[model samples]
Target: MDSLNIEPTEFTPRINFDPENNLFEISGFSRPENVIGFFRPILKWLDEYSDSVLSRNIDFNKSLLTVNLRMTYFNSASSKFILDILLEFMKYHSRGNEILINWYYEEGDDEIQESGEEISDMLGYPFDFIPY
Candidate 1:
């Protein structure tokens, strides 16, 4: 599958999903004018990626997919979509794919940390929280 790389704007974040490298990263501030419009393509890309991986029966045990989420700030509208993105990765994890989800929050930022924790709890998945 081809990689999905979206440059970050002032209101949106940078999205780099490289299947070949087994690394995915989303970072920056997310408060786009049209949240749905901004996130729809990302969600679709993830769905397609999942389908591709499953169809090929790729062995992910040796090379785990690493997903890094480094968000400085995201509005409430964006938070739901962010949660949805994580849930998609959770699907891969549930299917016996080794997925390492790293949630990066700025040091001394309790709000971001708590948000990640809440999402982790909601999905019943533990995330590696790293304070940057």
Candidate 2:
């Protein structure tokens, strides 16, 4: 499958989704004017990836999906979409997929860490909190 790479902008984040390498990352700030429009393609890509995985009979056990989130700030609307994205991974995990989420935050950034914790808790998935 082709990878999805969206450049970061003043009001958006950088997205890098590589299925071949099992690496998915979203970094930078997210405060787009149209939240849904900014994230719709990502959600669609995830859905397609899920379908392809199933249709291709990929081995869930051996496929390790790594998700890295390095967001410094985001608006309330973006938060909802971020949660939705994580929930999608949760569903993939529930289906016996090996997944690891790394939430990266700057040093001494309590808010970001807290947000990550909250999201991880909501998704019922364990995430490694990495302070950089």
Candidate 3:
């Protein structure tokens, strides 16, 4: 599958999904005017990625996939999409792929950190919560 890269905008985060490197990252603000329009392609890319992994039956333990999410602020709508993105990754984890999700939040931002915690709990996945 091809890599998906999107530059960050004033109201949206940057996206860098490099399949060759097995790395995915999203960071910055997210309050898009059209949330679905902004995220639908990303979700589609994830679907294709999942399909590729499932088809190849590749072992992921050797090269763990890493998903980094660092957001300063996001609207309620964005939160739902973020959860959806994480849910896609949850699929890989469920299939025994070695995956790592690093949820970064500002040192004093309890809300963001808690949000990550809640998502992790909801998905039953472990995320490394880092404070910056």
TM-scores of all candidate predictions against the true structure: 0.93, 0.95, 0.92
Over 1-132, each residue of candidate 1 has an lDDT whose tens digit, in order, gives 899999999999999999998899999999999999999999999999888765477555545789999999999999999989988888887787778889999999999999999888998888999998
5-72 per-residue lDDT for model 3 (tens digits):
89999999999999888899999999999999999999999999888755486654545789999999
Top-down lDDT ranking: 2, 1, 3
lDDT of 2 by residue, 9-43 (tens): 99999999999898999999999999999999999
Which residue pairs in candidate 3 have backbone atoms (N, alpha carbon, C) closer than 3 angstroms, thus clashing?
Answer: none
- Steric overlap count per candidate: 0, 0, 0
How close is each model in CA RMSD to the real structure? 1.5, 1.2, 1.6
Error of 1 at 93 (Å): 1.3
In angstroms, the error of model 2 at 31 is 0.4
> After best superposition, candidate 1 residue 11: deviation in angstroms?
0.3
Off by over 4 Å in 1: 58-63
Instruction: Name the TM-score of candidate 2.
Output: 0.95
Off by over 4 Å in 2: 58-60
